[model samples]
Target: MTAPDPAAAAAPSFDIRREVVAVMPHLRAFARFLTGNRERADDLVQDAVVRCLQAAHQFQPGTNFKAWMFTILRNLFYNEGRKNRVKLDPLDEMNAGAHAMPPDQQAGLEFDDFRRAFWHLNEEQREVLILVGASGMSYDEAAAICGVAVGTIKSRVSRARAQLARVMEGGGLGSRTSGNQEMPAEMAAFLAAGTPPKGR
Candidate 1:
């Protein structure tokens, strides 16, 4: 019997490590969205990264690496949330310092406005929007990551947008500046891109 080469056995682990490094910022942002705290989000990202490295061998070829990592982090967040009874509150307090790229001012929907409108949305609606619309993942990719049907993901994004639009149009949300608000689709995507890594 021929002896197995150590380097050959470890090649996939190397690849996984590199991919994880590249995807870390994204994981942090998503974790912050889910956990609603920077410290807790960082911890979740660390745990998820460890889990990914430990399970590297199980990572299949041709799979979407970012999606896979996101799924792991999300599962961790929900699992821990269940154990700790974490309340899913409005995200105004979460990642207060961290922000996505500023969208067009001409669009007439400021990030502050978008963030406020986002607060009015339910958790599930925000979740799908982040996955599909903000994160720039295709509906199929998002559906796979979210473990839902493509149509379901599409419906969530549509409903989330429509509801947000209505929130802008129909005022009376507490602390939000009074006006007839409008959120362009491109603006949503830009604002969803999130800030850079290391708590920036």
Candidate 2:
């Protein structure tokens, strides 16, 4: 057999691989929130990584690699929905963050309230909230990943916050689930903590 050019078979760039490693926690969190199950969420992230590595040549330099990776994972969620649904995991994994929660905090009874109430949010609401509010993505980045207009992304985020707050309030808190209200403290803290690792 003829010798092949080793240069042509060079691996994905060190930068991309580093970013992918940094982004894994966020990707896992996003997948868990979207799929509403832990094991399947891990599976989704694994598949997305494999797909990303296979298509690394298509990655455009000086662009948003985080957004690019998220777009891949999001596409997998939709395109592979049938196979995914058969996993039959309950939306019971609605803590969403699963492992993302700070160790001491998530075990509180308050999060139980947060969990059931969060599960009340429709998937679209949850997705946008996680992307913009939790994952620390820009509005433009979220819109592009969602394949929606910027305005629509804004609307969904606004509504997601409102709905999340409303649901929690209405739940034993006895606050108004009405009017446009943003997510309350625990939600904010959770979202804040949900951001991807920052070391680069």
Candidate 3:
């Protein structure tokens, strides 16, 4: 009998690696939302990719690979947090002032204020918001990733929105509409872009 072809034998692993690479942009965006720092986000993505490769055998086929990878990334983030409480630097006011939008750019200012309020939210609140609100995942999916009840994820998203509204209002943005009102246009656009705010 001819010896088995090693490359053919490794094809499954290679396929999984390609899938991981395919979702890297999404992973990087999520990481940026989680870390609020580009450099740290890149490192987090790298670490998550490594963990995924190491645990490749444990990954069941015919599953939601993106969700699986996201779960791994989230767990890795929390694990590292527990081991070494990483501290991110505060947003740079000087940089913000230097890049300040023109006075007529009211929408830009509102978006900037929203970004500031977003970072002020607690990690749990922020995570739920990003997962459901920004990332467009269903509450059920977010709940699974968060290991919480569906209602808990909903509650977190609601509280996060309320808190963000309060923060913006406190910053002289005025009261937002109530009762399932549409989110602010600027906020919606910002979240849709999924990019970290300047000076974060």
Candidate 4:
């Protein structure tokens, strides 16, 4: 028999890398939600991508690649969190340049307030919301990544939404044009985007 083609042998690995790169934005957004620090978030994404590359052989084809990558990222985040508590630097002038927004715009101000409220959420709540509500993962998929039951994921999402509603209604942020009865349209768009909002 002829020797196997080297290019053919490497095809799967190359495809996996391509797919991983395609999802980098989502990974970074998730990392941001987890760390709340831009630099740390980038580091976390880098680590997760490295881990994914090293473990590519274990990834099953036709499975949900996004979910698998997210599991890797969440595992990495928790593992690192256990090793060292992350210290977040304040968003000062030095760092502000990285994510500059027009202060005069109403949408920008509202987004900033929403981000503050989002970060104020407990870790579990934040994770669940980002995974299900923002990242658009189904509850079952999120449950598997989070290592919890589907019901648990659903409950976390429900409570997180209610809490966010309360926060917005109570002026934890500013008044939303969507009114107090529902989540603001901008916040809903942000959650459903499954990636970092613009200027984030």
TM-score of each: 0.72, 0.70, 0.73, 0.73
Error of 2 at 191 (Å): 16
Give candidate 3 regions above 4 Å deviation: 1-10, 92-103, 172-200
User: What digit string (tens of lDDT, one per residue) describes model 1 on residues 1-200?
Assistant: 45656776746544675688799999987876666667777989999999998888778867788999998888887766568735666564533532354433433335556667676777677788888777778999888878889999988888787777666555544422334544456654543443123355
Cα lDDT for residue 197, candidate 2: 39
Alpha-carbon shift of residue 80 in model 1 (angstroms) = 3.5
Query: Which ranges of candidate 4 are over 4 A from the true structure?
Result: 1-9, 88-109, 172-200
What's the distance in Å from true for residue 65, model 1? 0.7
How do the residues 46-146 of candidate 3 rate in per-residue lDDT, one tens digit apiece?
99999999999888887777777888889988888457645755364213442267744555555566667677777777788889987768888888888
TM-score of 3: 0.73
Candidate 1, residue 113: the lDDT equals 65
**Clash count list over all predictions:** 0, 0, 0, 0
Tens-place lDDT per residue, model 4, 32-75, is 87777778788888989999989988989888898999999999
Q: Looking at model 3, report the run of 10 residues with the lowest lDDT sum.
A: 171-180
TM-score of 1: 0.72
What 10-residue stretch in candidate 1 is worst by lDDT? 189-198
